[model samples]
Target: MESQKGKWWKKAVVYQVYPASFKDSNGDGTGDIPGITSKLDYLHSLGIDVLWICPMYESPQIDLGYDISNFEDIHRPYGTLQDMQDLIDGCHERSMRIIIDLVINHTSELHQWFQESKASKDNDKRDWYIWRQAKYDDQGIRKPPNNWRSIFGGSAWTWDEATEEYYLHLFTPKQPDLNWENEAARRAIYASSMEFWLKRGVDGFRIDAVNMYSKPPSHPDAPITNPSMEFQWAETLYCNGPRMHEFLSEMNEVMSSYGEIMTVGELPHTPDRSEVLSYVSAAKKQMNMVFQFDVVCIGYGKDPKFDVVPHDWRLSELKKAVENTQGLIMGTDAWTTSFLENHDQGRSISRFASDKPENRVQAGKMLALMNATLSGTLFVYQGQEIGMVNMPQSWGIEEYKDIESKNFYEEVVKTSKGDSKALEKAKRGLQYLARDHARVPMCWDSSPQGGFSTSTDTWMRVHDLYDQINVADQEKDQSSVLSFWKTALKLRKEWASLLIYGDFELFDLEDEHCFVYAKRSDCNVALVVLNFTKKERDWKAPKEFNGKSFTLLTSTYSGDGKPGELRPYEGRLYVQV
Candidate 1:
């Protein structure tokens, strides 16, 4: 493992905030930077080391803030550049680092660079983006240059009448992919975007869809994976492509210029273990860590995430994913990121465990223990600490605001052709997999609109159970989910040696509904035992662990250091005494 002598990030807890849903200080029914600044105390109280704000750049709102129109400016609705500076200063004053999303994989079609590239055949920025001539079919009809499919749905190629060319867009048409092959484009992004933020005192960046930056040189048509598919496969061609490491290394040179900064890339496809290690290896000096999708893909059905599907996961699947990831980087200089949910995925309590009223707290604590204690940088998304559940199933298709979710719903309904079961499946998929499930406003209190905003017309509807799950209720109770998170974070920082730099091993992989693991460092050992189910299960201390005297570090139950039968959904941490 990389030396943990001065790397604060090795033991840091990062809190991810979807700026649009965090808070709104102006009562404009939309969250803003000032609103986030106002909540600094609340965040610091939770003992987080860094705050990871989602994209706030200028955009057309096609994919929330993911589609950047202006790299250096802030989105109008999010507030002015001054507001961002204030937010940064506020965080620094509180000794909390702030990292914003760096979404350079693609830019909105409305972006000036893209507009100029599509304006004419020989514009100055013509090569800035990937554009190609359309091929004519036997019937004299125009077809895309290649058979690449968009991640959102349909063809990845979009035709431009003015230029008589098809531009590449791996996501929605508005998000046209950038050509990283152009050295000028890469340098321009570094000068105009990344350096601008680093100069503003922002600690680091969470690169969005980082693996899609490089595309193949040949630009050949993707192979047909399924005979009856509407579009061909493209992820294999573009993701982790030939020149990805080269581009990242060039970018890393700039990051290294800064004294102390963190960078974590969000890699979509499951990359080979050695390939992943190269990205974050201390010798490579590329990225500090990466967020791979293997663990999160357990609940994804037979297909990719764009296909609407309900939760279909086994506890063993999660264990395998976690184990494989841990095994790859156990004694290596490379590092990994651990997170159960993000802006693209649903809540963990709802997706991984039973979120009924009686089991919410226990389930939330159990999931927290599972991720927070592992050897990685832990990321806690907004509302995750408070045990938030998925949105009500009564929400209809119209209630959904996410473009990807809505597009999936239309695709399923159209293909189903009035099949009742397919329609029901789509509804369940939305409930379990929709990005909107994590986009709901953070419930700060039981006030109108859950204290997210004074306006009743918030951007997204507040969770219906806000009254019982709000921060106000949790703050008063010592056994609340929020309290457990605070305690967990406190213990993690206090025992950094055992949790951060220790050796990891699964305690009992054979346990049906319980996940047990141990962290050993030198002569000290820390055991983490968790029950993923709602019903109480009999668990005996393993033979090797039974002989040693132990001290309880933390638990979901109300007991002290006493060892006995674990309750339902209980999680206990024990340290050798």
Candidate 2:
């Protein structure tokens, strides 16, 4: 008997599609809702149960679609509201759920609320966004009210001469932070924006920058690490403030009325597991789950992600992070979102696999197997199915389109005055943290524009290795990475009772290069093992199972059934017979 555990979303798998990079239907060199509609069958075939489409709301394109200008309408480039409805209908037709990105943490400066708020200090909407008076030093140099750094770069505050006050923009200056402190603003987001989509049949929302919605009562300066550098910290004050729970509870009250919805928040630099549990526990009445970056960000060096050091991570450390994160809410009502690559990060195969051609496929399959067997809703980003790698080293900074990536490079140059060493370091940072690595257009086939678009110029260049890694080639090969993902998802669904609800236990097998674990329940026991390095390793059956025979359910290396030795980059799921 499998442990009695059930949740609609817990049994479903989600696939994230970066709208601008997914598919281009009209030769505009940009992806739109219609483009997505054209690919519904393709998505359905992948066994994906939920489609998490990134923001398509009307925007100024300042920070890609994250800067929403109109919460109720589709961006012109993405198509009309009718197209969105049609996409929703199409998804529903194929028994797939649609969840849009809810980017309420901030809105484009072009949004009506910000426009009126900036029109005059006395305007009724002035408090809709965080506004503070400028502080003048003894020398009469006007500075921001507090020292807070923008995540993109530079000061978090931007001077607005029209109002003679500065406004907070934690991201790009064009994306102003909303004042969640105001109850009315919260109601507007909840009633007018969120309700519009929920009523339109969107199954749920993936709340963007959910923690940044709350702000501290006092505006305080972050401790300055280096006077020359821009304000280094603002997230500490704004994320998960004292009133955050109150606001979330209020929103949850409203969301409960919507009926059977799944919500996940984007949480970065989270404090600890307890805080996360508070937001996701069934009793919390907040979101259903949250996306945390503790495991993925582990490779950052001295400069927290901007460092120029070559990437390095040990398998033991990765395993420890996973175990810790799993320990936080495992077997509890709270849940976590499991993902390896998303729009903001580099491709996983490139970041984790050996450079040799043979290892890429095995490594990709290994990652899929490990993530799929984990006790959470799995999220697969586009192109990950084909084992996509990072853009070639030849890509210059000029070719990148990600606002954050470009801003980081510019900040380094401005601080270092175009010094050759500084420029090289900046390049290294871009190569590692650039969002464009995952935003590159999907490679459907080995045609011009990789069959992503008919236009000669795409928004971003396609990956150079598309010829070998395109979906067309992979779909034809039963042993390809794409096929492995299909198998993985199907197997996860088939073993939902064991894989989804079974208690996870780490194996005592001793090998630095191997990650070993098991999921156990009354009726079944499944072993998940992976070789994280480029050298072969031994997978010694545990002492209790030494004399028993295990059947191979799936293997990246097509290992011999006895499994005394595992191949490089090998991964396997086995069931005791």
Worst 10 residues of 1 by lDDT: 302-311
lDDT of 1 by residue, 380-446 (tens): 9999999999998887778789998888888887888868888787778778888998999999999
- Per-candidate Cα lDDT values, in order, are 0.85, 0.83
- Tens-place lDDT digits, model 2, residues 360-460: 88888888888888877789999998888888788888888888787777777877889999889778767765778999999999998888899988888
User: Which residue pairs come into collision in candidate 1?
Assistant: none
Query: Which residue pairs overlap in candidate 2's backbone?
Result: none
Cα shift from native, residue 173, model 1 (Å): 0.4
Worst 10 residues of 2 by lDDT: 1-10
